[model samples]
Target: MKKIIKTVICIAALISAVSCMNNTKTLLPNVSGKAGEVIIVVGKDNWEGNLGNEIGGLLARDCEYLPQREPLYSLVNLSPGAFSDMFKLHRNIVIFNIDSTVVKQGVVYRTDVWAHPQCVIQVNASCADSAIVVLEKNGENITGAIEQAERNRVIANTLLYEESKLGDVVAKMIGGRVHFPVGYNLKKVTDDFIWIADEKQYSTQGVFIYKYPATDEDPFSEENIIARRNVFLKEYVPATAENSYMTTSVFVKPGIKFLKYHNLDFVETRGLWEVYNDYMGGPFVSHSFYSKDGKDIIVLEAWVYAPKYDKRQYLRQTESLLYSFEWDEDGNDGK
Candidate 1:
């Protein structure tokens, strides 16, 4: 029995490998849709009924930490009959097939169906009620997969941009490296603090990296993080007004969680940030972790200021930099 199980596992692995190869060789082009956009293919009848509500409620949920509420994904409702070659090339897609002929409910997730780097989710059910039940059971996982696909795309896009010396500088000074786009420039640098920003006409995107001695375990606490962040921002991120500086807002108190990513265990914080005496404010995210030597605590943060537009995409783009952190293992260099 054990031998049979092993053989089955090997066969499954072989099949998966072949599938991945085929997906790569696919003639379809890369996805053409924008980030945070999803195409939902459903019949017109069900598109406006309970079925629509379930799908929208799950995939179109609100994104957190944005000043204005925006759906997690910008959904495009397309009819199944109209799902031509054009629509199939979207980055994220969901097809809901509700018909009595579909005997049982099941979901099929296909990658690169009509484009490279794409995710296509198909839900089939014999009736509307059963479809709703299946969706409720698997909604979170489906949405998570879609979000991850976009994030991977963003990371890939970041690589296409020119590598900034800012990343190299950080590696040497802070004992870790974070990739930055070419447009980003070194805005401010001081003992134990580094600020990088890409300033545009109507928007500003920034990152803050700093380190402090790891005196105790309490430094990773939420309260301590907020306290320390305030000090760092106040000193480095001054506003236009006199004595005004950037600080985390207490009204919507920041949220923190412990997570492990890229082999580094860290605390993540998400919340709103406001100028101390000014009205300018937006969202900020941060990750706090320990250096390789275990003597210092490193904090890498990303924040955005786009008053006239939605911030979900901006936040995601900047957040990708935090995931790009790498530690130097050879000890010869930080880059």
Candidate 2:
């Protein structure tokens, strides 16, 4: 039985290798589509039926922590016949294949099928009912996969046009670095706080990095993190109005979740920020984690101020910068 199991595993590995080779394309075109857009390929009947509704409801749910309501993804449906080569190059795609001849009734995820840096997820089922079952079981997984792809694209672009000088300053200040894009510049730098921003005429994307002494208490708790963040913002982040400073918006209580990504455990907070005596406000997301030496709790926060336009893409682009953080190998204590 053990020998049989080993043989089966080897066969599976060989099949996976062959499948990868077949899917890889040389000189693939770059993906086309606006950020936060996804193309869904399905039959007209299926798309108009319960399957389409399910997919739409899952993918089009309102994004969290935004001041204004915005769908998580801008979904575009295309019939199987309309999914031509032009549509195939979209950055995000979901294809539904419902047929009686489908022996493998499951979801298959592939990347860069027809274009570089693309996410293509195909759901195969013997019938429409079976397709819903598969989606219900893996809804969160599907959403997460697409979200990661979007973030990866932003990170890739940031790395390509990175501001290396700002990264060096962050490493020297915190013993870690986050890749800032070309437009962002250092706003302020101090012993324990660093501010960076990409200020445009109508919109502003900002990031704050601050550290405090670690304690044995529940440091990652929502209340504690908010209190600390408010303290930093009130001290460092100020508005044009007299004595006005940024603080957590009490109108919407911030939400906190612990997450482990890229081997780093951190507490994430999402909510809105407002100036104490001013009208300026927008959405913000922060990641609080310990320094490499575990001596300090470092908080990296990204906030957006875009009253004139939709903020979903702006917030996402700035938030992706926080995910690019990495600890420097050189033993700099960030002194």
Candidate 3:
């Protein structure tokens, strides 16, 4: 009888031990959450949309990023050891904060951010600039997830004003001559970049090519540049009248030629407009002008309708974007 009792006790103890080990809670990253609150497991903005409130809900779930440009200070936010580990999981989302202050000699430099997997190749600063990342986990991750109720929130409010400013300006200029954005919004905006584009139509062709991963398309292939061709527009833009007819004209500040620009033909025309292999499509915007002859430094944008689009439906799915134009040189639009 004593031996049987002792055997029962040992079996019970073994069972309890096994249960505790099984319920110890696993340590792994998860992608789910409520609005506004960020999930720190990953150091990037994983929000679904580029702008607005619904973005808040998605933001809590993962780190989303403005992939159009290289991350500088944000990459440094995470500790080197932590960042290296996160990168192993193939994290694509990113969060970038473009904070700027005026320094001597009239220069604006962006000085900070909060993110993972970052770099600063384009900024006019050092790669060794210091940065930090903050992590917060409230409740059981998805405890208080709220839908995007605050439409007038910071992200939504800012995007509305600026997007309207750019969209309205372009819409007014084009008016009826060409099809402006049927729907538009700022998918991404920062000190260095701004993206104000929506899902709209151009010619009666199928889907526009800007709808693909721009980083992997052949700009020279007819399968691609045809969108720019299908919407054959003939207009006279009163440019600086100098490099106005060059085949490779890059008119933004500092100038990024053979990259982003339209071939408008009003008074003058130039350049073999080719979408670079790395240029991603969707949520489009017209390029910026270096200087201007009044306000009509007119740039005509061309778009076409895809076969099965739901009429301005894709207005909400832009990936990574920003707005700003700094490609001009000496106000000469260095071609």
Best lDDT among the predictions, by candidate number: 2
Q: Across residues 1-335, which tens digit of lDDT does each residue of candidate 2 receive?
A: 99999999999999999999998757788999999999999887888999988998899989999999999999999998999999999999999998999998888999999998999999999998999999998899899889899999999999998888888888898898999989999999999999999999999999999999998499999999999999999999888999999999999999999999999999999999999998989999999999988999999999999999999999998999999999888855432
After superposition, candidate 2 runs with Cα above 4 Å error: 1-25, 333-335
Task: Give the 10-residue window scoring lowest on summed lDDT in candidate 3.
Answer: 119-128
Weakest 10 consecutive residues of candidate 2 by summed lDDT: 326-335
Give lDDT for model 2: 0.93
Using TM-score as the measure, which candidate wins? 2
RMSD of 1: 7.5
Candidate 3 off by > 4 Å: 1-284, 287-290, 293-295, 300-324, 331-333
lDDT of 1: 0.87
Better of 1 and 3 by TM-score: 1
Superposition error at 43 for model 1 (Å): 1.8
Summarize candidate 3's per-residue lDDT along 36-67 as a digit string, tens digits. 22212222332222321222333333321211
Q: Write candidate 1's Cα lDDT for 4-120 as tens digits.
A: 999999999999999999888648787888889999998877889998998889988888888999998999999978999888888999988888988768888888888989998
Candidate 2 Cα deviation (angstroms), residue 318: 0.7
lDDT (CA) per prediction: 0.87, 0.93, 0.27
